[model samples]
Target chain A: MAFDAFQKRKERQLLWLLLPALVPLLILTIYPALYAVYLSMTNEALTGVAAAKPRFVGAANYLRLFSDGRFWNSLFVTFVFVVGSAIIGQFVLGFISAMALRRKIVGAPVFGAAILLPNAAPEVVAGFMWISMLAGGDHATLSKILVFFGLPYVDWLQTFPLFMVVMVNTWRGIGTAMILLTAGLAAVPAEVYEAARMDGANPRQMFMRITLPLMAPTIFLYMLISTVSTISVFGLVYALTRGGPGNKTEVISVYIYNQSFAAFQIGYGAAGAVVALVVSLALGIAYVRSLKVEV
Target chain B: MAGISEKRSGAYTLLAYVTLIVISIFCVLPFVWMALASIDSNVQLFLKWPDSVTFDHYTKVFAEENGVRWFANSLFTVLSATFIVMVVAGLGGYALSRSKAWWKQPFLYAILLIRVLPSTALLVPLYKILLTANNGIGTVLRPLVGEHYRFVMQLFGFIDGYLGLIIVLATGQLPLALWIMKVFFDGVPKDYEEAAILDGATLVQRIRRVLIPLALPGLAAAGLFAFMSAWGDFLLPLILLSSPELQTLPIGLFRAFLRVNEIDYGLLAALATIYLIPAVIAFSFARRFLVQTFSGGVKG
Candidate 1:
């Protein structure tokens, strides 16, 4: 009975400890999220009559959003961005880098440092840095290099907005992918590799049969993180293209921002944001389910 | 047979080295070019190699543009947010780690779920809340403070101030910080605290003397991450703090790009370089701890 009373007291203390974190989270995260749902059903705006007196439209914004071609375009762009940058580019290059770093090569630290350095720059800073390199003109770094090679200088960003954005995001994200995959690589036991070698398994076969299967959970976790975060990437893409050159690079986040802040349609933007939320929640559930299966 | 295998292994090693070098160059080339552009004059930017380097662009960042103010604003907001996250996450993490409550598992999962939710989804509603608070607080304070109404209103204002941004950032980072700290706290043995309790050490005393010192590295790692996220953030500050005087580094750099007529490549490059310095320095200092945090997170 005395021990039970002590346990109850301890539970109360734990609740008290949680208050500091929970209060801010409730206000900042939970409240905003619930409010977003409410806002999505109204005809709110930052200006005009809608700003002065927003009325409940009851899914009108969502209905309009479903019909909007630009909304569809943003979703398509987001799909390509997530796949090109996070799934394919970062994973492939990052896995290779992780595998390379695992080897006892000369200058391995220097190579690791170089790969890690790009992540140090903030998104907008990295975006501007790339703008200098891939900016549309004869004077840009890529153009200058092409000119030196006796080739015509091409405006990279203008000619290929989505591709350039994807490439830049991949560059910024490879370090994170490499770090996570390296941890995964380390967890695979050396004795397993030795056994495979003794069984006359070639390197490629060993990797396919052993390392890839072992690293599946970690890879899924990385994908879950990178995909969700990449979907919300705003500053980098915005700073680079501003969803311009005819909205060719308007990912969902940018589309929402343009609608809310640029077009001043808060309700419409909230509806778009709701769609983004649902997509992310769906992706999160899928990844979590895969993780459970892997475990 | 051994000789043939050795020759093939040598070729494989050569291939690995070549690949590593090429990837490293691909990663580093943009920063090198940006640095070069920062030091070059407009005319020199077009040249293959500049004849001379100049600090003209660097000077212009401070002289014409208010770079110092933006840097200070960023420093203040990030540091304040980091401090809040450390305090809140530290307490909560200790509870989650040490407690045996049945609710802890579900609560922890909820926190993780909150972390995965895209922050952009909350932007519109957050904007509305801030706007409401701005008007509501003004009306509430007008009668209470009377003569000192503006000062009091600004203090409570959420729309365009440091307080709102700090709160939002701290909340956004709390989950990761809490998780990292919890992992560290779990690593610490219970024997020390048990012994302390036997000697009649108070809860605060046990925490301060025993738990904190052991978890210092974890705390530092979490604090560094929180600081970086806050410092590097563009969206929250962009929408929340609308005043020119309140601009952070990312916002400042963006404005410079937008506002400048000729798109002064040299000046923009210099500003970006300046913005990159603190993050690089922080990463270099905390690289080991940060990596350990990631590994710990993944293993769990």
Candidate 2:
């Protein structure tokens, strides 16, 4: 059992090495996640009587959350934000950008860097810049451009708050989508296109028959990752409109923030948090399973 | 490879060029406004050619505002967090790569699942946990530190302290760094370690001599990602630190922005640009690693 002893010692040493990383993640992430589920069933608060004498009220918070119109609004807004930006807006633009970049076009790198520059911006900074661009004035950056092109100036954000939010989110993330889709594109062998060309396939046919089918897996993974991340988006929504112009752009994260901190309803916020947690965890499990099977 | 190019009509090629240019403009316009406004003597919310360029806004951020303190707080905490991730993940990654224990697979999966847990969802209970820890630290330090209690707690207390922020930020970044390192070490040749073992190198000596040297590239990737992510984080600082002195750049910029009536675009832009530069620099270096990082963690 000398070899077994040696193996045992090695495993023990390795486990010790992982302890520092493990301890904090457990204390901060995992423990709190479980705590959130527990917190949801209670009537916790940051102030007043509930803060001092918090008591468990099983499913009361969830029942309230389910019936709350604002809660439903936040969920609906989140759905639109994810689908509009990550799913449709970023995907379509990113796909086009990626395809165009594949043409070995001039200034491809410049174009790529230009697209990615926004991704480098912090959420507050991005929101700040967009506020300028979409401000309600004749001289706003976007409006000035519109005026130059014989279009009228309108407050982009106020006029279409949800759409503007979606657009800005799309602008910020197009680079990621482009990067991921570019990777996916590269995976499709050039020889397949060559063969398709020989068979009298046009660009459209090649894309539909060859590219789309082949890129499905990468596209799926990209969608899942982006969707989950998008669901968690708070800073951008907060910066642009603190869920304002009515409940127009109140994504779930922002709603949770407004509820927990602004409204001082910690227990109710935990209910929302738990729902988000469950949804994200389910998607994450699917992502992990896909990674295992594919990679 | 060039078959598609030949098949693509001249008109289509022209279309591609146009598409790239337009998209690039859309992407870069906001940044253009921010950069120009930051320096313009008379700034506007709208994009315009600067009438006269001045560095006054930048200087004012440091001199008139709490920019220096905020920048320093952000830099210190984020850099410390990045360093912590690099070290912790380096060791843990090596272990995960080498270990045949029953927990290894579960641990890897756990970290990935952790990545998916939205930070907002965790924020509520995380606040509570930090509060409890902050109280415990207060109890231990209150009598001991006496008059220096405030200053001491600023560094050590969990709720609003440097130590708490650094550790929490580091912990937030650990899953990815660990995943990166584990995958990185899996690719590293085991012969070096085996050779070091044959040379009668003890475990510590082996790690110091072999693993650390070999893990540098992986550690750099881990650290850079950690820096970029932590630098961009808004929620952590916004939630955890309540004191003005403890406010990081994002919070600082955000609060400055909230002064609606007298909102100084020039000063805010300057602060944002200053805040953004390091992240952009880190991101530029981290660019090549992106494909690898996404296509399953540096696996060739």
Candidate 3:
């Protein structure tokens, strides 16, 4: 365990280097996390001073969250949104694109970059685009198209705001997922595919038994990140529906914002915020464990 | 391989190309619509497209409104924040890479905790901290630095201004930037640095002359990521900035689009399109870097 002077000096230098980064990390991040935990336990309201005489309400917030119908509904909406967008919509579309491109199809690089355009587009803009398309032309693009195809011109936001939001989120998210998956697809050794093909494994069979198994870690990581991202689906929903013609599209993040900023229920809002953090933390831990197993 | 596959793979290649083209068009259709609608006149916007287009909205946005000022404010704020974050994360990442330090694991976990913590949770406490600044230690510091500093550099000054947005956005972006830089730095073999050190190079010299040039791509990727995160940001600006002139593109676009009473899809599309240009350009340039970052980080 006799370390050289160089090693000791290196360690000292490293510590010195990390200190500047650590300050903001501590102030902006660590302090906020601790403060949130502190805020969650209080009976403080949004309008007033955080109480000098506040009573501690030990898990009262958590208890209330379970009973709240809105919380449960929002949670369901969040899951569906993530699954629809991140998992099925983006993830699958992304995988297929990656797979096709991996076959060394002509213009793959151009398509690969093109696929990322949606993810790169500003969310606010995405909302507008979807709204315009779904809203249909006044003379009626959807209606005309639907009629031509023997379908109905459904009012997307009114009857199907949740579905609309999920589709929009998926549209935006597919690019990122596709890009990550393409990278994952690129990393798979070509010889493995060749060997499988030589063994008379059909493309579908190879995908299921070999490609899928090898790509599990990437899939899991994408799932976790996508889930975390989708849970906070605020901007798209906000821009599209404003939590709706009813409360149909009101996910947790928007609800929290309304409660805190608009409704001015500071303590209750903090409680909602804490719940989101806890749920995400649980997911994060599960993801980290899975990552550990993969490694 | 190409000649052998020319006929058989030709059909499959055609199918793939067709599918990819369709998807790409669908992906870019929003932007196409946005550009079309932005220049569309008010009647054309609300009613339908005519044989021609107009630039009335863009003109209005540029001249008769606070849109230009807001855009400038956003650029200034986000750029400043991005610059600050790059410097901090670069230094921090270098340290983390080079050292087998005592607090390294804890430091990394701390950064992760920050990364995972939702922005909503921090709003209340941050608000309180800003609200209380000038009354206490702030007063003491204010007099020492003269009243000008208080007006210009105080936390309260930052609380609702571009400065505050810069700090919060920079803070939010710091952990990721640091992590990316750390990974990038880690990938750079230590042998190069070891040779430099043995040749009597100082720490700064080794960093400036050896490490930086090698890590330019990583730095570009990190910088672009930071810029996008700050630029397309909504929550931080929404929570912190109350001034209309202080709004960023995301917030501004959201505001314009969410004018529920009016419900102008054409104007909304136009505004959204305008808002999206920077991101589209930035991502187009940095797409490869972005893909690499995600894959490398997630792969590990």
Candidate 4:
């Protein structure tokens, strides 16, 4: 009876403890999310009668979104961005860097610091910094370097907007990917490697047989994070291209922003936002399930 | 065979060193270019090396443009948000960590769910809510404050205000902070708290005297992250704050680029360089904690 009373007291204290964090989330996150669903169903605008009245249109926004070529294009762009930056570019380069750091090569600290440095800059600041480098014409940083190499000065962002954004995001994200992968690497036992070496296992064989299997969970976790985060990446890309040189680089986040703010179509933007949220949630669940299986 | 294998290994090591150096240069060269460009005038930007470096652009940014105001606004918003996140997360985390409540896991999952959702998903509705709430507050205060109602309205109109942005930023950051702090609190041994309990310390007393000092590193890490997120944020400020004077550094720099018909590369670079300094300094100071937190996160 005494223990039960103490437990009840503890629960009450815990509820009080949780209140501060929970209130903001309830007001800001939960309320907004439910509100988004309502907003998505209305013909809402920042101006006009739609702004004031906002009559429920019920699935009309979703219908329009389904047919919108630009919406499809944004999805495709986001897919390419996530795949290019997170999966291929950052993952490959980050893994290589992690492996190299583990080898303890000369100037490793300097190399590590250099890799980590880009992340220190704000996303938009990094975007602006890159704009100076990747700016068009003979005077831009990349162009000048190209000129020295006896090559034509390509207007990089204008010509390859999607690719340029991917490259820059990969540059920014590589540090994070490297850190996560390094942690995974550390968790692998030295004894396993030693055992493989005793059996005269080649480096390739050992990595394929041991490292790949052990690192699967961590790799998936990184993918889950990077993919979702990359999908949400707006500031850097927005600051760099504003989803421009046409809608060529307009990822979902940018598309949502444009629809809501620039076009003043709040309902349409909320529809896109909902889709993006669903996609992220799906990816997160798949990853969690895979992680559970691995465990 | 052994000699040949050793030579091959030596060659691989050399190759690895070369690769590392090349990659480092690839990463660092942009910042070097930015530094050089920022110090040079528009015309000198194209030159391999400028005839003379100047701080004229920096002077122009501060004096001509309202760089100082934007900087101050950013500092105020980020600091306030970080402070709120730390306090709320610290209290909540300690409770969640120590309590054996049946609902703890469900509550944690809910927080994680909210965290994973793209914050952009919330932005549209949040903007609406802020607008409606501001208007509602304005209506309520008008009758109460009489002639000073306009002044009160401005305070309530959070859409273009500091308070609104801080709330939104803190909300977005809270889940991560709470999760990190909970992990840190869980790692703290129960001995100290138990002793305090035996000594007849109240919950607040135990928390103040025992829990906080032990979780200082975690708090610092969480605070640093919250600060960085708030500082680097573009979309929140872009959507929430509308006034020219109220704009943060990112918006100010972006507008600076947009204002000129022809982009002034040197000036833009200088503004960007200045904008980068606080983040770089914060990152350098908190880098150890940041890395430790991430590694711990992965392990957990």
- lDDT per residue for candidate 2 within B195-290, as digits (tens), equals 998899988999999999999999999998999999999999999998898999999999999998989999999999999999999999988888
Which CAPRI category fits model 2? medium
Write down the worst ten-residue block by lDDT for model 1 chain A: A286-295
lDDT of 3 by residue, B1-300 (tens): 447546756666677777788778767665565677776665332224544677767766667556787678778888898888888888888887777666776666556545656666677777766556524545566777785664454234556656667777888888778878887888899899889988999989987999879878777878888888777777777777776756676787777765668766555555566677777788777776766555324211
Q: Least accurate stretch of 10 residues (summed lDDT) in model 3 chain B?
A: B42-51
Q: Write the per-residue lDDT of candidate 1 for residues A1-295, one digit (tens) a residue.
A: 9989978987798789889998888877889888888899999998999998999999899999999999999999999999999999888988999998887799898998898888788889888888878875997877888998999988889898999999999898788788888888999999999999898887889889999999988887888778877888888898899997898999999999999999999999999998988887777666555555210
lDDT of 4 by residue, B1-300 (tens): 789768867876777777777777778878887788788754344434554788987888888789889888889888999999999999998888887887787777666667667777788998888888778777787789999865554445678877788888898888878878888888899999889989999999988999889989888888988887778888899888877767889999888877657677777778888889888888777666655555323211
Query: Worst 10-residue stretch by lDDT in candidate 4 chain B?
Result: B291-300
Better of 2 and 4 by DockQ: 2
Cα lDDT computed for each candidate against the true fold: 0.83, 0.91, 0.72, 0.83
Candidate 2 ranges with C-alpha deviation above 4 Å? A293-295, B1-8, B297-300
**Ordered list by DockQ, greatest first:** 2, 4, 1, 3
Which candidate do you rate higher for lDDT, 1 or 2?
2
Model 1 off-target regions past 4 Å?
A289-295, B42-48, B143-156, B290-300
How far is A251's C-alpha from truth in model 3 (Å)? 1.8
Model 2: clashing residue pairs? none
* Candidate 4: clashing pairs of residues: none
Which model, 1 or 3, shows the larger TM-score?
A: 1
